[model samples]
Target: MARPVQTPAEVLGIEPAGAYHRLLLRAPGVAEAVLPGHFVTLAIGGRDSATPLRRAFSVHRADPVADTIELVFAEHGRGTRALARHRPGDTVDLVGPLGTPFPVADAPETAVLVAGGYGSAPMFSLAEAILARGGRVGFVLGAATADRLFGVAAARALTPHVAVVTDDGSYGARGRATDPLAAMIRAVGATVVHSCGPMPMLRAVTDVAVAAGARSHTAVEEAMACGFGVCMSCVLPVAGADGATRLVRSCTEGPVFDGTTVRWPEASPPEPSPSVEPREVREVREVWEVREVREGVRS
Candidate 1:
């Protein structure tokens, strides 16, 4: 992994992506270093705004040739709304390719990827990486509605084995993404599963993967006040290799972890100040109409 660098990255473009926005930036160093599941933090609200905190976003895509990176997010709060206001050629302070990346298998194998809403951002690149390694990939994507679900076309372009679900039945099925997960794993004889989404969905994915005896990797959507692991706001009690549960920072030690090892919370905790990971509880329940974010942008 490469060390992170803080730079004043120039905005290359911003466009509407269904209910979300896709931001592109000229971030050579960050873009070059970022891998699947790695994220970046952006200082929001400008230099003299009320919200001084940064927002984190998972990397949607990084183009080393173009020296650019792309991020997908919903402008539901003050910070993101401010970020959405940025125009091409504008500059934003960026820090990243931070956090642990999703570990890819050294040898090609059958795999499945699960994503919810914009959480699908990181999964596409991950799929490409897996495919490049001669691995087979399948995708399970879900959202509240068809409009909210992302990357179906992209996923299809990657592989024919794609399943889509929506809460209201406006898409493939009227259910959560996890609904068909087990069957997908069984169908493909997948040995590995990867996911990026709200906390609850990740927990469910872990359960299904574990039940199917597949190794699972999940990129958590925890709110981070500091993307460098200093604020301690993104800690989650995770079971370590020795069977002891310890609080781990999502920004540093993970954003991606062994799904079977996470100690899932009994109940949804209070939605953290909206900072990074757009597919959290707030978006699931409220549809991202109104919310405040905290740590810098991830994607």
Candidate 2:
């Protein structure tokens, strides 16, 4: 692990990737220290913004040689829209190589990496790392539609086992990405699974990996008010190796965690509570009682 750095990174370029934007920044120190699953936080809206929170994005690509790092993100709010407006020469204050990165196996092993939407960003770097370490890599990428899917070409460039799934059948298979994960893992003889996506998708990936008897690592997309560990905003319940589920900060302890270790939020329907009068009905009944008492007093 490397110490995170806060530096004023100059924007090198910004380009569109499907519905998202790929931002390149000149931050040699942060780029050099970044790992596959590490992310960077940029101060958006400049100095006059009301909110002081920084926007966090996974490190899509890190080029220490070029002294640059890339971040991929969709313009989801005012902050992101502001970031998207940055030009090549603009300097943006950023903190990087934050959070726990995906753990790569020292020994070469067959592995499957999964992504949903722009969550594919970090997986590309992770794939590169795995391949460099002589590990076999396969990708399962899914999104609501074809335009929403990303990194299909990038994944194919790394390996021939890339699987694409779209909810609308716009491209590839018409289903969730996890639909093919178990088969792919078995086919590839993968002993490990890595995933980054929506919580439900990650949960499904985790379930599939566990069923396939493969180790699972998931990078969560939790909202962080502070990209560092200060705010405790990105805390989630995760189980320890000892099996105790406790709150842990995603910023420091992890944005990546053993899939099995996360105490995933239960999806079960809420139990029916004891019957109670509606507020409106109670209020109407009270009004009726008051009227009756007034009539009796008049009588």
Candidate 3:
């Protein structure tokens, strides 16, 4: 059965690190059903405005005994920035424990988790669940710089096999996370790969895992208005069971999906805009004028 949405949750505490923040909330109903990889939509200020209707954030931690749920989010846009203004003992409206979770391995298996930026939020709980079931786990985290890499130290506490990658060589590897991830999968022979990041990165991980003959799953992020299935705003194209392409709701059906089932399109060259003239045509007159000027100067 679906859990009821809880609004007006009391803020238990606030913890800030770099650009990211963790808000611990006490809401009895939410604490019961929240699982790893599940998310909640928070309505800031209890307002009905379009900007702050509800913002979805992953469940960083859930303690049923204490009736508390923790949400770790980066201050990205308007809604999140507003959420950052909140302090302890304040009330915030929320709705959730929504979306399908990553498939739990039925047996002992090697699992690799890859995350980019704040995408790491959902994987912590997943790692804990896997560890409890005696599953072997490893992690690969990627960020633009070391300062942006949140939760790497905490993740290391759970597993020793953690690799950090930064784009500008500020921390670990001087390349994207996909580079080390592919290397790790090859060396460790991971049985299953789970990833959450930007679409391009997720696509790259999917390709690498597929080529290596490893089963993989991905958590996709998209614009979601309503956390429930009613809004239909978070639809994404997916291959149906009949091999035909159809749109699926990212909110209800999944934020997590099998990588193999997704259809990736072939790369194509950039198309010129209809309103813009050809570059060669524009450069021809400029070249003629430059040559005339050069001849005049010589004379």
Candidate 4:
């Protein structure tokens, strides 16, 4: 069952890491409140103004005993910039535990985790979860350069089997992280692949996984407005079980989906209509709106 979405809590701590900040929030009574792959949505501005509502972020760490949840976000936009200015004891609005989590395949004989840029957040917890379940974990992280490569040390600490790839030669391999990922998968004979990253990297990883006949799951990074499914901003075309293509809302149905389920086009396809008369479309929209309203009231 889904956990009830909560209101924004107070900022407890802000630890800086390069250009990003690890924000610790106190959501009292929300103890043991989050699942491994769950995320939280935080409102940036005051309620009276046209606040950007809530921005969704993956829960990097959730400590129920401490009544705290942590989010690691980069300073990119107005909301994020504002978040950077917040000090301890400041209150911020939030609503969450949204969306389905990445499927945890039981100790997949051998598993490989591939992440790029900020995409490492979700994969980090996922790796830890898998390890706790007795699964062997290997990591392949790609970044623009050594400076942009975050979480390598942490990932390495979790498992000795880690490979870093950078666009520049400042890191492990001079090529993209996918190069090392492919190499590592081949060398270790990885059976399952989990990835979260840029679209190009995801596509590349999908191709590699498909060629190797490995089951792969991908966590997508898309623009989301309503952390629930209401906004329709994060819908992507996916191939359904019936072989027909359908649009799936990323916020609700998935931020993480099986790579094979996505309808990848060879060339740029035409945009899908926002208002289709299909029953499924209507149902999806309705469900999303209801969830949004419920979340709004809680916030």
Best-matching candidate per TM-score: 1
Which of candidates 3 and 4 reaches a greater TM-score? 3
TM-score of each: 0.89, 0.88, 0.85, 0.84
Error of 4 at 81 (Å): 0.4
Off by over 4 Å in 2: 266-299
Q: What TM-score does candidate 4 reach?
A: 0.84
Writing each residue's lDDT as its tens digit, candidate 1 over 1-299 gives: 34899999999999998889999999967787889999999997567866666899999999998989999999867789889999999999999999999998778988999999999999989999999999999999999988898899999999989999999998898999999999999888899899999889999999999899999999998767668878676766777889977767778989999988887762135444654554434434432221112111111
Native-structure RMSD, model 1: 6.3
Q: After superposition, which runs of candidate 1 have C-alpha atoms over 4 Å from their true positions?
A: 266-268, 271-299
Query: Which lDDT tens digits does candidate 3 get at residues 38-119?
Result: 8888887665544544788878888989989988888875678778988889988888788877888767777889999888
lDDT of 2 at 210: 95
For residues 157-180, write the lDDT of model 4, one tens digit per residue.
998889988898787888886787
Alpha-carbon deviation at 87 in model 1, angstroms:
0.7
Strongest candidate by lDDT: 1
lDDT of 1 at 293: 21
Clashing pairs in 2: none
Cα deviation of 62, candidate 1, in Å: 0.1
Clashes of each: 21, 0, 0, 2
Question: What lDDT, from 0 to 1, does candidate 2 have?
Answer: 0.84
